[model samples]
Target: AMAGLTTIRGLVPAIPHAPVAARMPSEITSREVLFVKSLDALQRRSQLSLRGSNLAAFAGRRTEDERSRLKRVRNKEDRKQAFKDFRAVATVVSALFAGLAVYLKYSDSELLYDFDITDDAVSIIAGLLFAISFQYSSPLQLLLVFFGKFETERPADWVAARIAGVDDPKAMTEYNAPAYAQVLSTALIGALGLVTASSLSKLGDTWSLSTAVGTAFLSFLYEVGRPKRLSSEEVVAREEQWSDFRQFAEARLVKAGSCHESEIFDAFVAAFPQYRDDTEGKAAFKQLRRFVYQWNPTAERTPYGFYKNVALSSTFEKGKTSALDS
Candidate 1:
């Protein structure tokens, strides 16, 4: 582990990744140093266990204890990977925000427009740069990758793992907890960046700091907290979903003037068993409730609040009656 840390310190600058290089600092207080040192010691002692015939034996003949331990390790690794992807998405967003801040900071303070460079030329150049950015490794590319129609890389077989009975043979695939941790972790990383940037600039008054912090928190949720089932769809499709099921629930509640929270949850689960039973079902459930609550803020937040909340929400009541009346 220590050796790997040392290698990273020496080799990171050589790599062409500016973001990572920018983050690297004095390593004396880094926990990664200790982690690397431990890893190095273990590797030197029994590297063969990870290679050759020993590897096959390790893979095939895991004891019950080893299997359990490995399951936890696998879950942690999966969460780590998911964090990385979400963070990258947020990074693009944050970078764009920083660029915007730079422009805003300089727009009126300096005369960027002179006789040498007219505002028209500046506008043209900006448009050209924006157009060029879409084709390169920029937020525009990521936006397309996120929202544009693409070939489904996830094959049907990946979801076909028989993970019904935990008491039975351990499924080759593993499930993870909800994205609560991922959201929190991503939010913290963003907060840290905001703080560091503010401290360095020495210009983070309450309003500016608040804006930076809010941007970070919001970008993290936009990128990470949304469930896969609820994401990667057209805005129209997503809006349709919101209106469709929200109305469905509202209709059911109007008859009773309210329903139990469990009733609503069961209704959704019944309609989308595949989604509700999948690994991310809990996350999807949370997303559904959050969406419902947000669209109709009068919705209750108690165990029995759904029906009453929905019934009381004037926004929901108006929409529900108008739709049904139509």
Candidate 2:
């Protein structure tokens, strides 16, 4: 009976040992499962961080693009406002000058007043105001006011050529001394007529009328005989060439096919705002516009030949000398 009890006790201890060994594998498996879950969580966090970085980069690019677009829009608006301001100032000054001219004309006692204190003062004031108005006006308008119709048509080419140091080919074509002498003689004759008319007017006689008529006729003849230091023919030719060039330029602008003519015109005006008062500059612009019209023949009315002749007299002088030498 004692031997049987010892064997039973040994069996009990063996049973407990077998259970402990089996439980060790289950605990190890549980720890491995937890580690795997932690790794998965860490991987998910890394992916999220990468996605956030990409999103931020995209937003930064979008912001830069918006800023660039805004800058362009602001610049365009500023240019437009500047042009409007210039025009407004010019219009106001022009009106004032027109009023002054009317006042002077009606207030004068004589049919033609000499440039006395009153006359000189009015002229000075009017000229100053006119000059101011022309400051921001288009070059074409200013040229017309200063040089009349004689210098407008080809002023650009003449100026360009002069700037480019081209010698006037027509200067020597006419007799220089004779041309100037004729102009001086004509001017002197006109002055004499003016004097005589004034005297006759003071005397309350009809002599003023006869003297004026005679002076007019004499002046006309003198102008006809006067040799141009710059040949009129050359001036005309240059003007025509400039006109052609202008047409070509205009055609290119039109071909650009922009919907905004005003925008284009404004850009042109902006580029040459000083052209409004620069006689030659304005003429160049007018010629360009006219050329465009001629090319298309469907454009609006253009300036008359008034601003076409303000060329460098040196050109004509050279031509005259050449002719004399020849």
Q: List, in order, the clash count of every candidate structure.
A: 6, 27
lDDT of 1 by residue, 1-326 (tens): 54665576566434535576457674732555565566566665655645655755554455445657866876677678667654543554355445544564567645432311122333323322322222112233244456753322111111212122223222222223224433333333333443344343334234333444444343343444333321223344446556656766555444323444555666666665544433335545556666666656675555544444443233445554222223
Query: TM per model?
Result: 0.25, 0.23
| Poorly placed runs, candidate 1 (over 4 Å) | 1-244, 255-258, 303-307, 311-326
Residue 293's lDDT in candidate 2 = 51
Q: Please name the candidate that would achieve the greatest lDDT relative to the true structure.
A: 1
Model 1 residue pairs with clashes: 1-36, 1-37, 1-39, 1-40, 2-36, 2-37
Tell me the whole-model lDDT of each prediction, alpha carbons only: 0.43, 0.42
Indicate the residue-level lDDT of 151 in model 2. 28
Best by TM-score: 1
